[model samples]
Target: MFNRKHLEAILITRTELRLPRTTPEAVGIRSTAIAALLDAWKESGLELHSMMILRHGQVAAEGWWAPYAPELSHMLFSLSKSFTSSAIGLAAAEGLLSLDDAVISFFPEVAPEEPSANLSAMRVRHLLMMGTGHEEDTMGPLSSAEDGDWVRAFLQVPVGREPGTHFVYNSGATYMLSAILQKVSGVKLLDYLRPRLLDPLGITEGTWESCPRGIHTGGWGLMLTTESIAKFGQLYLQRGVWEGKRILSEEWVNEATSKQIHNGDDEANDWTQGYGYQFWRCRNGAYRGDGAFGQFCIVLPEKDTVIALTSGTNDMQGVLNGIWTHLLPALTEDVTADPAAHEALSDKLGSLTLEPPVLDAASPLESEVSGSRYVLDENQFQWTALSVQFESQEAVVTLENCEGEFVLRCGRGEWAEGRGVLLQGAPFQRGANHRMASSFTWRDSETLSITLRYIETPFYVTSELKFNGDELTAQQQVNVAFFSPELPSLHGRRS
Candidate 1:
């Protein structure tokens, strides 16, 4: 849990001068490039979805693509590592542990009876720097182990290079931090960070998934509103102070954001910016936290700016180059608003909203099956829902299809209440690739469906919901093969 006094400290505190959206840019940005960037972003097909720009602590520019909204919590991907690193700093401040401490100190039992030089020499700092010397462990192979053996599994991996001598982009290393933080702090990462970070920033609630070991996945599984990521960038922009509270020490910020390793030196990667604790350096002096597809919170000290972005996969290099070639040039020390142009630009920024997912026109079948019923239409093409309750004004559904089962409550969109499930396997703590893009399209009154489409493999899946009261049926289909394998469609209409 978050420290109570810290939570109380910021609860009623107020800022003397609230930050404004736009700083007085003496030679303000060129209004023309703003539209140009948007066009280029879309034309490039980089799956660029939402953007928020803060200049001098105000929302200088912000916008979201259709379907994507400011309110939705986006996957941070690798960007989550930065938060993990920040938590390390916070824990250090609280005297929970120090980065310099030996990682084995937290898990003394994980070391082998006779450890290798690298294994014995490994420290917590190396893990933060992606220099853990693990030969090869990706996509959470460590997670498959018994919860208690996870750390041991990681430690047992042979060191390909000396600890702290090589820079390997390792998500597994970050997971260990999540595990170790829990071990040392005696609290889960999100809950521990709530008052210390979230509550202070006004993020009242969010869901962060835990690994099989039940530790918050430090390297991934963090979901935050696009705006919240912007706030984090803002906090870093102010060097870790928010609304007058010193959240993190300056020393931690300097070390974490500074280039700790040249990660992509041989790989010829976009992280051309270099790697810090969990942050990647940008072309200029800016640093950012990024995820798969596209989730970014780029902070530039020289420009006194922060840009928070969420996106789907298309092209990452294009996104970075677009920002640099277009947006960066516009960031002048003196930016005077073209009143005529400013209105349009303001209209452009912070504009766009998702239309409510509405049920389509009713049909004869829809009226007939308005309540619920047991559906065992196809054996392999099977769908069954449990707890298929219907309120006068709502639809409650919990269903399992070939792909997976999700419990959705929608008073508004697809779900009967506030919950929802994607036709694809839900987002997992393993990595960024696990994210699913589920969009809803109501087929008829009796059937509402969502498609779980992946940017990569395991793509193109559809889930159809058939409604009745005590019995409900759903169908899941993958657009992969001409003939998908027959599945034994389990049948049990949830009462």
Candidate 2:
């Protein structure tokens, strides 16, 4: 049986034993330089979740913000495309498929009765390089198909230009690549790559979201540990060789990482440099596989380094900028051992955490509304009632929504961990038993503010409950979302 937990699983180990840990000086970089990079990232106010810097196949420096530990799997969004590309490379090596094979040939049943010239010319290589000729992304239509036939829906999308002559970041194209791989291999993408790729790297745990047809969503929704991401980057940096054995052909790695098409003209922007097979070319002759909202596996071949990072921020460019500004310089220069700097860097990395809600005194309204259930007006969320109870140092809130009752224990200016229904809707799975951390603070005399962090994913929710006499007004918003971040407000009266 297919388990939903495996698709969005969270591991609970505390130690990172998969990779060798070492001092920054052993990797040709000063410990202070890494500390400085951390300082710069903190100053920029990016919501970084985890970071792992590796050089010479050794973990030089690594850290995870509180609640976002090394054991937990972080969502990789579009970064999964690179893994799908790897599967394609492996399949090609086994003669299961070819780069030049016509994509339409894989699914003749789903193909349009009369395929266009552009669509017929589309090849597996075009999908790998994001050179599909569609004028825009086909995801919108592909996702909204009533029958859930994504392959057929994708094939029907008109190709606006010649496949090899135009470049469009089409995720549906990636999905087609996944469907083709499954068609040729007779198994799921993850299972097919497990023994050949993931197992060789000691990555035994992972999950990929599947489509309605049980195919993995090739372009997004992959979850893996920070260390697992580093291992992947390290493998690519070493030309697909792991432990003196070649897991992937050097020919495939070279062709995949080399710039296959020009993307833009901006010399300063990283996205414009060029594009390879499921990889983005970087400014300093490096390449990377990056996802939306800042999940990155950056490989710097010239410097022999790989940096894995996971974060939640609107400014993806800001992250790469910080890396270029501080971390890039340290990679090239030689530095002597400084025990004091190494100790300082270690301490800083050890203590890294995202600040919780601000500490504030309890509002007098807490006593009046304590244990009182508020009967809420009908809203889109279908929340019918809400109740709050205060204790010695924590606040427990009970909410009744469409999914039934959800109880959250929030610490006062600190995080309280628990497993319960994830109240944030849409992109997040709506069910119980999701790992989360929460903190609450009194914003004013009558307002109670709370922060909910879904630790396994790059998302958090901020809610405010305001009380006036017998009336209650509740407002909630997510930090980032595929849907609208501004959720509907609820008005209610004490019951």
> What's the count of clashing pairs in each model shown?
29, 0
lDDT of 1 by residue, 99-128 (tens): 888777788766778777777788888888
For model 2 the local lDDT of residue 233 reads 97
lDDT of 2 by residue, 409-448 (tens): 9888877877776664535756535678888999998899
All candidates' lDDT scores? 0.66, 0.87
Best by TM-score: 2
lDDT of the structure predicted as candidate 2: 0.87
Residue 42 in candidate 2, Cα distance off native in Å = 1.2
RMSD of 1: 7.7
By summed lDDT, which 10 consecutive residues of candidate 2 come out lowest? 1-10
Error of 2 at 18 (Å): 1.1
Report the lDDT of model 1 for residue 139.
42
